[model samples]
Structure formats: C-alpha cells, structure tokens
Target: MERFQRLDAVAVPIARPNVDTDQITPARFLHKPRSDDHGNYLFHDVRRRPDGTPDPGFVMNRPEYAGAQVIVAERNFACGSSRENAVWALYDHGFRAAIAPSFGDIFAANGLKNGLLPVRLPEDVVAGLIAALEAEPGARVQVDLEAQTVTLPDGSVHPFEIDPFSRHCLLNGVDELDYTGTLAPQIDAFMNRYGRENR
Candidate 1:
C-alpha cells in the first residue's frame, strides 16, 4: 500500500449516484487470474459499447481526463456486494482518492485497506466540486489527507471526514494486518514470559 499524505492531480468527474461494484468491475472479470491486470477490466461494462468498442460517452474516455488520479462522484458510490477487487481495479487504474457525498460502507473499507482515500463531504460540497471538475477537466484538485481537506480549483477548501486509524494507516503506508504484524515482537515476549510460568 502506498502512503497518501497528499495528492495534487487532475480530477475526473463521474456524476452518477449508486455506482455499484458490478459497474466498477463486472462480475465476469472477478475470476480472472490476479496477475491478468484487472485494471484492463475496470468499468469494462460501462466503458465499452455493445459492439465492443470503447464508449466515448463515459467520463473516463475523454482525453482531457486521461491520467487523472482523483475521482469525484455523487452519492452512494460503489454500492454493491463486498468485493475488494472493485477497489483493486480502481487502484490499478491509478486512482489514489475518491471524493463523494457518501459511499457504500464495505467499499469504503476496502478502499482504505488498499490505501485509497475515500473522502466524504456534504452533498452540496460534493456537487460543487464535481461540477467544477466536470466543467474544467484539465484542472487539478489537491487532496490533503493530513489536513482532511480538499482544495478546489477556485482556491476554496472543503473539509471531509475520515477514520483516524484509517488515516494513520494511509499516511504510514500500512494495511490493517500489516499494522498488527508490527506487534509480533511484543507478542513473542508475552508468550515466552507467560508460557514458562504456566508450565
């Protein structure tokens, strides 16, 4: 997991709500070998037309938003069954943070575990940010995880909320289990001291 102290990147605005996991990465691609580059299948269904050509209508297909690292969306983003792979596909596609009004609980968790910052701001704030990014696709937004703020194009700032521990993990580039693994030495010491006495 990469540390996410702060990021300044061009933003891609996907102005839809309730974008579920299936839409993010269709179920068919779920069983593919992990080494097969899941990023290729990110938003496969939405990004491709029926005849297999790329959908030019999708926000990501636009050339201006190419190499954008931030995703701004509407309410209830990534609402679907708990599949960590959805987060993987987005991460593999180089999205470091997602800003929205709300997100599916499980998806948010998955995102944090994978070092993706899910910023939850108020509805109006998100709407304004998305509107600005959509209108100015070449513009960049600054996301400061340490400050818990999103700096918009107009030089204004909006604050967002995140779990403190999750923020710590992201800043330190550690996953949940990786954090626990850091305590191994203490665990070994405790076991050696207590086990000898118990015997």
Candidate 2:
C-alpha cells in the first residue's frame, strides 16, 4: 500500500448519489485477475459503450479529467454489497481519495484497508466542492492526509476526520500484517513465558 501524505491532482466529480460497487466495476469483470491493469476496468460499464468503445460522455473519459487522482462525489458513494475489488479498481485507476457526504460502511472499510482514503464532509460542503470540480475539472486540488485537510483550487480548506488506527496505518504504509508484525516481539516473548511455565 502507498504511504499517502499529500496528493495534488485534478479532482473529478461524480455528482450522483448511491454509486454502488458494481457500477465502480461491473460484476461481469469479477473473474479478472488483480493487478495494475485493473484500472482499465474501473467503471467498466459506465465508461464504455455496448461496442466496448470508451464512452466519451463519462467524466472519466473526458480529456480534462483524465488521470484524476481524487473523486468528489455526492452522498452514499460506494453503497452496495461489500467488495474489496471496488477499492482495488479505484486504487488501480489512480484515485487515492474520495470526498463524499457519506459512504457505505463496508466499502469505506475495504477502501481504507487498501490505502484508499474516504473523506466525509457535510452535504453542503461536498456540494460546493463538486461544483468547483465540475466548473473546472482540470484545476488541481490538494489532499493532505497528514493535515486531514483538503485545499480547494481557490485556496479554501476543509477538515475531515479519519480513524486513528487507519490514519496510523496509512501514514506508515502498514497493512494488517505489517501492523501485526510490529507486535511480533511481544507475541514471541509471551509464548516463551508460556512454554517456561508449562515445562
């Protein structure tokens, strides 16, 4: 997982609500392998047409929003059945964070565990941010994970909260195993003591 401290990119807006995991990556593609190439399949259904040509109408296909690293969205982003692949698709697509008013609890957890940051702000605040991104999709926005702040193109800032454990893990580039590895010594010592007592 990438250790994310700061990111600057053109933020893209998905102004609709209740964007589910299937929409992020269609169910038909679930059999595919996980790799950097997964990005090509992100939002497959919406990003492509029936003939498999890129849908030029989708925000992702628009020239200005190409390679966007952040998604500014409406409420209930990532709402649907729990699927870690959804997070994988987004990460592989190069989006490191999503700013929305709310998220599906399971999707948020899956995303955070995979080093994707999900930011929650008031509905009104998110709406304003979406408007800005829509008005100028190529304008850069700064996401400072260490500061827990998002700096808009015009220089305004909005703070967001993250779980302390998640923040710690992201800052250090440690996933669940890496975190458990930090306690290896303690676990070994406790096991040694148990062996001594049992003997």
Candidate 3:
C-alpha cells in the first residue's frame, strides 16, 4: 500500500449514482489473473461498444480525463455488491481517491483495506464538485488526508470525517494486517511468559 498524505490530480466526474461493483469491473473480467493491470478492464462495458471499439461518449474515453487519478461521483457511489476486485480496478486505473456523498458500507471497508480513500461529504458539496469539474475540464482537486480537507479549485476547503484508525492506516500505508503486526512485540512477550509458567 502506498502512503496517501496528499494528492493533487485531475478529477474525473462520474455523475451516476449507485455504481455497483459489477459495472466497475464486469464479471467477465473477474476471471483474469489478480494483478494490478485491471486498468484495462475498468468500466469495461461502458468504455467499449458492441463492436469492441472505444465508445467515444464515455467520460473515461475522453482524452482529457484519460489519466485522471481522482474520481468525483454522485451519492451512494460504490453501492451494491461487495467485491474487492472493484476496489482493485479503481486503484489499478490510477484512482487513489473517490469523493461522494455516501458509499456502500462493505465497499467502503474494502476500499480502505486496499488503500483507496472513499471520502464521504455532503450531497450538495459532491454535486458542486461534479459541476465544477464538468465546467472546467482537467481541473485538479487536492485531497489532503493529513489535514482532513478537500481543497477546491477556488481555494475553498471542505472538511470531512474519517475513522481515526483508518486515517492512521492510510497515512502510514499500512493495511489491517500491517496494523496488527505492529503489536508483535507484545504478543511475543505474553507467549514467552505463558510458556515458562506452563513448564
């Protein structure tokens, strides 16, 4: 997992709500090897037409936001099934963070484990961000995890809420397993004392 202190990147506005995991990475693409190259399959159905050609109308197909690393989406984003691959697809596609009004509970947990920042903000704030990004294509949004704020293009900042433990994990690039491993010394000490008494 990579440390995520702050990020300033091109924002891709996905205006849809309830974008489930199946839509993110279709079940067909799930059979492929579990690697970090799922970017090629991100939004597979939306990005490709029936003829297997690029669909020019898709937001990701637009050349300007092709390499966008941040996604601004509507409410209830990442809702529905809880497939970890969905999070992998987003990360593989270079999206380090997603801003929305809410997210599926399971999806949010999966995202945090995989180093994706699923930011929850007010509905109006999310709508404003979408509108701003649409109006100014290729505009960058800065997300500062350390400061717990989202900096808009106009120099305005919006504060957000994140669990303290999750925040710590993201800041240090540590996953749940890594966090547990941090207590190795205490575990070893307890085991040693118990073993001596058992003898």
Question: What are the models' TM-scores?
Answer: 0.89, 0.88, 0.89
Candidate 2 backbone collisions, by pair: none
Summarize candidate 1's per-residue lDDT along 18-110 as a digit string, tens digits.
999999989888888767777888899889899989899988999999998989899999998798889889889989999889999999999
Off by over 4 Å in 3: 181-199
lDDT (tens digit, per residue) of candidate 3 on 1-199: 7888999999999999998888998888777887549888888899899999999988878888867888888888888877788888999999999999999899899888888999998999888989988888888989999999999877789999999999999999877886678999999999999999999
Best by lDDT: 1
Clashes of each: 0, 0, 0
**lDDT of each structure?**
0.90, 0.89, 0.88
lDDT of 2 by residue, 57-82 (tens): 89888899988999888999999978
| Cα lDDT for residue 125, candidate 2 | 88
Which residue pairs show collisions in model 1? Answer: none
lDDT of 2: 0.89
Q: Per-residue lDDT for 23 in model 2?
A: 92
